[model samples]
Target: MRVLMRVAAGVLILLLIAAVGFFALAWKGEIEPVAAVDRAQFDQELIEQGARLAAVGNCIACHTVPGQPAFAGGLALPTPFGTIYSTNITPDPETGIGKWSEEAFQRAMREGVDREGNHLYPAFPYDHYTRVTDEDNRALYAFLMTRQPVNSTAPENELPFPYNMRMILAGWKLLFFEEGAYHPDTAQSEEWNRGAYLAEGLGHCGACHSPRNRFGAIDPERHFGGGEAEGWQAYAINTESPAPIPWDQESLAFYLRQGWHEHHGVSRGPMAEVTGNLGLLPDSDIAAIATYVASVMGEPDAERQARAEALLAEVSQSQSPALVDAAPAAAAQPGSAQGDGAAIYAGACAGCHDGSRPQPFGGLPFSLSTAVNAPNPQNIVNVVLYGLPPADGEATSVMPAFGGVLNDEQVADLLAYMRERFSDAPAWENLVELVARTRSGEHKVAIRPSDGIERGPENVGASGGAED
Candidate 1:
């Protein structure tokens, strides 16, 4: 027994030493780089393409905070581990990527290493960026390098021990990261391939739409099965979708490009940022993405799709108009604190979401609303708490923020009513707790919840259809 114990101790010591040595060597990356492009020479075409690519990646969305110069990164993205502040991508020599050469930039994107050879956290989404085409990478570099330099330092990362051991990421890359470029599928159509590349490579759509494992790495098996972002659930765009009017390429293209569609609805939460950024792309690029996503999330058969639309049109999106007009009845239990959900909707939501109303606000119907039928009721709760930020620049939204107005119980009541009336799905349990957590900012949300993005009062949400 004594001899066995000694052997085990020796093995453990050896393993620890090996791990320490391995980390020391691996942390200082030794990978070779491809030939560096001549950074001094770039043209308008590269700059233009880079701009388009950046829009697709929504690079500025994570890097910039409200009131900050674009790409002067300071936003704190909350993750399970800790807050990871985005780094400055501007051309500032002291604080931004200005000092990085083309070789260093490409290595950072391709191998998840920084200019000084330190491993970059995956929070930067270099995993997807690794698959970006070299041509696109060149363009992105050209575009980013030309940006006006902003002299600002992002806050230091606030990660805990072990997690903050940046060298440990070497193993994480070994386990989860793959180095490669987008490989076009020969069997698929050119349009389909283009869309796939955009969605999987540049768009990095899965970052939000796909759930992560305990390690904070995306579960590859889930693919487009819905995931959480900025505390809001990014709805599944696959067969798992519970949308009343099944999504097709046409409707999706309209939604992606315009930020709203008659069959669907206006984008909100993190999706709003995505849709807004996508608006910068050409119509053809948007259409290609829609096509690829539609293929993945094949629409309901023609019959069911048509029938669902017809039902929505006939119903004018009223699940229970009579309920809305009725007086509030006593709680099902005498002492229960639950309020009348229908009455609340009548006072708050009906003026716009009710189909009988006029253009943008009037046209959006609730009975067939996707949020009402979601597997989890988080989407509805999110919209109610945060409210759709008035999108004056794109699809102008009229929805008001109830986060300050309604208590948790009220939001729960409203959510229950929406689910019961619009969808046949089971009632969401523990909604009050959920609302409380969301309001208190305990939820790991990826959205920048605000009242409006326009040059006006922060709390003033638009209330009418947009002119542009």
Candidate 2:
């Protein structure tokens, strides 16, 4: 009995010592709050620059609910662990960052702490924000402070025990978070370096594009190798990009600026919001981002380039004035399961997708669809069911919802047909289950319009809406 008691006491002592050390390491001192500064004090040019940076960061999308005032918070961000509500960033004295000084704001951006020194949840993406420069933070502060003060409080986070504990985040930081501003690559061009800075810091593109580990931190081994965001797959912006037509810098920039590419369909889901926001930035910045992303993706191999060339040629030939609006090619037998999907496609989809009309309005050919060619069918499923909606006051792509029209089995069948007919990749499994889950809201889908503002004739269909 005495020996057992000694062992328990020793274990208890070790645990207590570890606890003391943890508190010592995690503890942070609160900064003194300052009075709200007048908006007039900040320069107009600095505020404008901040606006562009905020757009790049996509701060408004996460911070504002659809109907609420911008940056007033209360946006519910769903995570694997739980839903975390974004805090009000407006300058309201009672409920917002009105009391937070420039130093406090900078600390929050750099270290993920609040004015009171409370550790913030990683749902805020501070893990990426930590790379932001002090100068950028100042600009952001100026922009945020100048906004109309809104009295709002975010709902309490719905995290479970241990995960909800903020002190635990200190350990997470130690494990994954690397604090520092972006360092330029001396070997790369000035544009590439600038792109790297914006993309790695304010853009926080990897937060969605990269897969996460069991602990919810980004997995370094497969960075930008594709991951999920709000139920949509952020396709690999790296060499593993599943786009049948490999993206070059020109295409990427055009897509980023105009929100659509003739070779690649319009941006929908969360990406639509990104493109919409990126419109605030200058063309040079957009080009820089494209340059950097293309470098990361690297050049396609000779085989891939040849294949893409072949596809482009085939599509080009098909779109000739003589062949335009011709009947679609025949499919599987009428009574078979594949035939059911083919019949549905002919009735519902072929009119637009068979390369009859111009693009940014007409549906893209399945051959050029990244969603169809992707490893998973989640995006294609989402698109088929929810469909794209028109952007308000803008000429954009529009597709009607089939969720109410098609049953889960039917949707699965259609997807299977598309998979077999359009892509050489393996067939998707459990598509019926996926369709059902997405339809029932068990897998929440964030459907947004393909809201790219049209940029005139230059921005229209590439290769004149060719079919591949």
Candidate 3:
């Protein structure tokens, strides 16, 4: 018995020592100050470099609120726990990063620790920012310094118990964060490498596109395979994406630059913000991104292609030609229900979306659209309630929120008209319910057609309208 006790005591001592050593290492990992960049280094060239980096990073999409100073930061991002507000990134002495030394910034960017050694929530997208080159980091820092300082103290995040604890983030980081700069692929072209660096590092596209684990850390195994943010379904950018229409490089580039296309889908929800920002980048940079994305496709497998084709054919065949022709004829006659819908469409929707003028940033036209033909009208109803804003880098086209302007009945009537006139699907009856659910913030738009019931033409006329 005595020998056993002694053995247990020895094991206990060893365990205590290990625990102490582990904590000591963690403590040592706290934020450290670094050498400051000389004021002389803050030149126009550096600022320009920073601007380019910012474009790649798409900083304004998250940092700038509508009608607010660029990068001043007041965007409210919702998560599973609660809402977290973006901080003031401007170089204000009190509210922003004015006092942070270059080393402090580097630690935050690479190690996910703030200047005060507080473990920053990964909501800042620092996981992907960890891959940014030091030079680019320096340039980004310089550029941030040049912005006008705003005295905005962000609201405290309303996260649940353990998540609110900053120290716990250290453990999360230990599992996911890797300290390093982007290493160019020797085998890929210079353009591809550049695209990779921008996409993975400063751009941090994976922050939204990549799926996350239960712990909220991105699942590296399923990189860019779709995720959620701010109640919006951020779809996968991978080649294997189940989008009804496959995204070619040209269409992707056009969508990124413009915001919409005929063959590809339109940007709505969070993607609208991304496209708005990407639209501002140089054409050459956009082309580079396009080229890199194109390289990802090496002819989809025959089975997948066959399945997609079969699905499309099935959807096409499902519509009745006689009903499709008769529905429009009924809509054309004055005093008919379709006529009421037409009047609503002309009065409420025709001001901006008539497809006659080229949409700013080459936005897709709404006339005779598949989105309109959808059986589920929830997306359309939601859009009519909350108008979509143009993405950060794209052409400016603000769809005004009609939540206040149109009541539930008006929205439903308008949608009914559009569907009957433009499509052959059944009318949507769940529109009012969908609007209530969406307005109450109960549901979000689905990312893929497979995720929910396909919206049909009849439902399109019944539900509401498309905004994105």
> What TM-score do all the candidates reach, one by one?
0.84, 0.91, 0.70
lDDT of 2: 0.83
Per-residue lDDT tens digits for candidate 2, residues 123-165, read 8888888888999999999999999999999999987654576
Answer with 1 or 2, whichever has the higher lDDT: 2
Per-model CA lDDT versus the true structure: 0.75, 0.83, 0.64
Tell me the deviation in Å of residue 346 in model 2: 0.8
Cα error, candidate 1, residue 193 (Å): 0.3
- lDDT at 401 for candidate 2? 78
Point out where model 3 deviates above 4 Å: 1-25, 28-40, 296-381, 389-434, 442-468
**Model 1 C-alpha lDDT per residue in residues 252-347, reported as the tens digit of each score:** 987887666666766777787788788779999999999999999985887777779686666653436664344233223333333467667666
Q: In candidate 2, residue 274 scores what lDDT?
A: 88
lDDT by residue for model 3 over 46-161, one digit each (tens)? 88888878877878867877678888887777765456778888888678887778777777888777787777878888988999878888888998887887888877888755
- Best-fitting candidate, scored by lDDT: 2
Candidate 1 C-alpha error for residue 367, in Å: 1.8
- Error of model 3, residue 452, in angstroms: 28
